[model samples]
Target chain A: GAGVSQSPSNKVTEKGKDVELRCDPISGHTALYWYRQSLGQGLEFLIYFQGNSAPDKSGLPSDRFSAERTGGSVSTLTIQRTQQEDSAVYLCASSLGQGTKNIQYFGAGTRLSVL
Target chain B: DQQVKQNSPSLSVQEGRISILNCDYTNSMFDYFLWYKKYPAEGPTFLISISSIKDKNEDGRFTVFLNKSAKHLSLHIVPSQPGDSAVYFCAARPASYDKVIFGPGTSLSVIP
Candidate 1:
């Protein structure tokens, strides 16, 4: 792809329902990241995957929030039993590698609204 | 505690003037810092960055300054434009941390 891509540009789910957001990182990129932004809030790191290293989940807000990067290419963020506060925009990004430490390019993001 | 902090929630600057956004970090282990700008319905895009060793870095109309001793950094935009109106976030990466920590953000309104 020309740039990082995300699925379900917008989602509206009822409280307690489960929702999944997907991300397709740039080709050959070795690093991927997931973040969330509430209305008028800053981006919050959720998780990251670097090559084969164990996915970093240190930033996940709660047990209901989880993600997986299958085969080092695409990722899925799953939220179980979504709450009203879960309504926010989920953003995905990728980089060539930390060795370069360049800026991470971002996707437009998926707006999730928990009603 | 938030390692990175942007105290200002919003700022208004006249177009063609300079706009300064400030950021502070509590952790001393951070090795790099960056600024990202985001518009409505869009993802944040990288603006400028400064390494811990350097005091300043400039790219065209944008410049980033780092004060390691104070654990603070700032982004300055000269000749601000209306197109530059957006939310700005400060981010920090620790030497040992692979992920970057972001500040709450400061919304800048460049008025004409």
Candidate 2:
């Protein structure tokens, strides 16, 4: 793909139900990131993965939020027992390398609504 | 805590005028700053960026200015056009950090 791509552009689910979001980064990119954006709020870092090393999950808001990058290309973010607060746009980005200078390309994002 | 802050929620500028958006950060460790432009229903696109070693960087009509001492940065759009009307976000990352912290966006309305 030319850029990062995310699945299920929009999702509506009931509270307490589980939801999963997927991201496919650009080919050969070494770093991938997940972020959450609420209405009128800035983007919040959720998780990061670099190559085959263990992902940086420190930014995950709670234990319910988990993400895994398989084969260093595609990633899945799963939220268990979705809450109303979890209703936000989940964004995925990828960069050539892991550093501050690397330019990150972002996907259109998946808007998830928890009712 | 909000390490990066975009105080202005919105700004309006007449067409052909200059649009200046400001961002401030409390973390001195940030060595790279970038500005992104986003439209409704679309992901953010990189506009311009400035490294801590330099004070200013320009590309086409967009320019980013960084003040390391004040921990402040600003994006300037010269001869703003209606097409430039969108939400602008500022992001900062330290030299060693891979994740960038974004500031609450500022909505710029370029009035014709």
Candidate 3:
């Protein structure tokens, strides 16, 4: 695709339910990132993946929030027992690689609402 | 802690005038800064960027100025047009870090 792709542009789920968000980065891009943004708020880093190495999961808010990148092309972010606070837009971005000059391209984002 | 911040939540400017958006960061390790433009119900797109070594960078009608000593940066859009009315976000890439820190964003309104 021309740009990053995210699945299920909007998802509404009940509290305590597990929700999964997916992202398909631009072709051949080596780095992928996940971010979360609340209503009218700044983006919060969620996770990062570089090539085949272990993903940088330090930014995950809690253990319930986990992400896995398969084959370095697509990624899935799963939130177990979603909370009201988890209601936010999940954004996916990708860059060429780890460089200061490399700019990231973003997806339209998936708005997740936990009721 | 909020490393990157845009104090102004919104700004209004007349078309054909200059629109200035400011961003400040507490982390001194940031060496690369970028500005992004976003529209409602859409993704953000890259507008301009500046490195710490360069005090200013210009791309057509857009320019970014960086002040390393003050840990501040600003994006200037000359001859702002109605199409430029959108939320502008400031991002910084810290030294040796792959993730970029993003600001809350400032909504820019260009009126004709």
Candidate 4:
């Protein structure tokens, strides 16, 4: 693809329901990241993948949140028992690698609204 | 504690003037800083960046300044245009980490 792509531009889910967001990073991008921005808040890191393995999952808010990347390509973020507070924009980004070239390119993001 | 902080929630600037956005970080280990501009219904796009080794970096109308001793950095846009109106985010990457921590963001409105 020409750029990072995300699925389900907007989602409206009832509280306690589960939702899954997907990201297709730019081809050959070695690094992928997940982040969320709540109302009046900054982009909070959720997780990152270096290839197929995630070196950092410390940012995941709770066990209800889980993410995985396969074949060092597409990635999926799953949220279980979504709460009202979970309403926010979920963003995905990809990078060439670490160091000076690590400037990430982002997707438009999926807006999730928990009703 | 937030490793990155943008104190201003919003700013207004007249077109053709300069718009400045400030940011501070609590971590001394941050070695790289970046500025991103985001518009409504769009993803943030990288603007300018300064490495710890450099005190300043500029690209055309956008310039980023870093004060390592104070753990502060700022972005300046000269001759601001209405198209420049957007939310600006400051982000930092620790020397030992690949993840970049971001500030709350400052919304800049460049009025024509």
Candidate 5:
């Protein structure tokens, strides 16, 4: 793909339901990131993956939030027992390198609404 | 506390005029800064970026200015066009950190 791609552009789920969001980064890119954006809020970092190294899950809000990147390519963000506060746009980005200076390409994002 | 901050929520500029958007950060460890522009229903696109070592960087119509002393940075769009209307976001990353912190965006309206 020419750009990062995310699945389920919009998802509506009841509270306590589990939701899984998928992201496919650009080919050959070694770095991937996940972010959450709430209404009228800035993008919040969630997780980061660099090659086959362990992902940096420091930004995960709680135990209910978990993510995994397989083969250093596709990634999945799973939320268990979603809460109303979990409603937000989940964005995925990819970069050719690892670091702050690398330019990240973003996907259109998945808007999750937990009712 | 917000590491990166864009105090102005919105700005309006007449077409052909210069559009200046400002951002400030409190963390001295931030070594890289970038500006992104986003339209409705679209993901943000990279506009310009500057390293802490340099005070300025320019790309065709967009330029980024960094003031390390004040921990401030600004993005300037020369001869702004209507197509430039969108939400602009500023992001910063520390020297060794892989995560980027984004500021609350500023909505820019380039009026024709």
Candidate 6:
């Protein structure tokens, strides 16, 4: 991919329904990250996957939020029993590596609306 | 508590003038700072960055300055243009962590 690519740019679902967001990082990127922006709030870190290392899930807001990266290339973020508060823009980013020189490239984001 | 803060919600600047965006952080462990510019409907793009070891870094018309003592960092755009108008976010990275904390963002409008 030319850059980080996210799918289903916008999603609208019932409050209790489950939703999944997909991210296809740039080819050969070794690091992937997930974040979200709620209304006027800043970007909040969710999860990170680096190579085959165990993901850093400290930033996940709750048990309902989970993510998985397969083969260190494609990633998926799933929200279970979504609430109204979950309505926001979900963003995905990828970088060459997690070193100090890491510069992330982001996707346009998927706007999720929980009715 | 917010680790990073961009107090001003918005800023307006005239074309050919300088646009200054400020950010403050409370965490002392942050070792790297970056600025990202975002336009409506698009993801943010990396603008400039400065390391804690140095007080300043510049690229073309964009410059970033860091003050370790004051826990503040600012981005400056010289001769601002209308095309530069967008929401700018300030982000910081801790030396031992891969996560980056971001500010609320400040929207800048450059008038022609």
Candidate 1: stretches off by over 4 Å? none
Backbone clashes, each candidate = 0, 0, 0, 0, 0, 0
Q: Mind giving the per-residue lDDT tens digits that candidate 4 earns over A1-115?
A: 6999999999999999999999999998999999999987889999989865545888999999999898899999999999999999999999986654479899999999999
TM-score of 1: 0.97
CA lDDT scores, all candidates in order? 0.92, 0.92, 0.92, 0.92, 0.92, 0.92
* lDDT measured at residue B25 in model 4 versus the true structure, 0 to 100: 95
Candidate 1 local lDDT, residue A65: 96
Taking candidate 3, what TM-score does its chain B reach relative to the real chain B? 0.98
Q: Which stretches of candidate 5 lie over 4 Å from their true place?
A: none
Instruction: For candidate 1, write residues A1-115 as lDDT tens digits.
Output: 5899999999999999999999999999989999999987788999999999999999899999999999989999999999999999999999886767657889999999999
In model 2, what lDDT does residue B34 have?
Answer: 90
Clashing pairs in 2: none
**Ten consecutive residues with minimal summed lDDT in candidate 4 chain A?**
A49-58
> What value does the lDDT take at residue A68 in candidate 2?
93
Scanning candidate 1 chain B in windows of ten residues, the lowest lDDT window is B92-101
For model 3, the interface Cα RMSD in angstroms equals 0.9
lDDT of 5 at B30: 91
Candidate with maximal DockQ: 4
Tens-digit lDDT track for model 5 on A67-115? Answer: 9998889999999999999999999998886644688899999999999
Evaluated on the second chain alone, the candidates' TM-scores are 0.98, 0.98, 0.98, 0.98, 0.99, 0.99
Candidate 5: tens digits of C-alpha lDDT, residues B1-112: 8999999999999999999999999999999999999887778888889999999999999999999999999999999999999999999988886677889899999999
The DockQ-based CAPRI class assigned to model 1 is medium
Candidate 1: residue pairs that collide: none
Which wins on TM-score, candidate 4 or candidate 6? Answer: 4
What's the C-alpha lDDT at position B72 in model 2?
Answer: 94
Which pairs of residues have clashing backbones in candidate 4? none
Interface RMSD of each: 1.2, 1.0, 0.9, 0.9, 1.1, 1.1
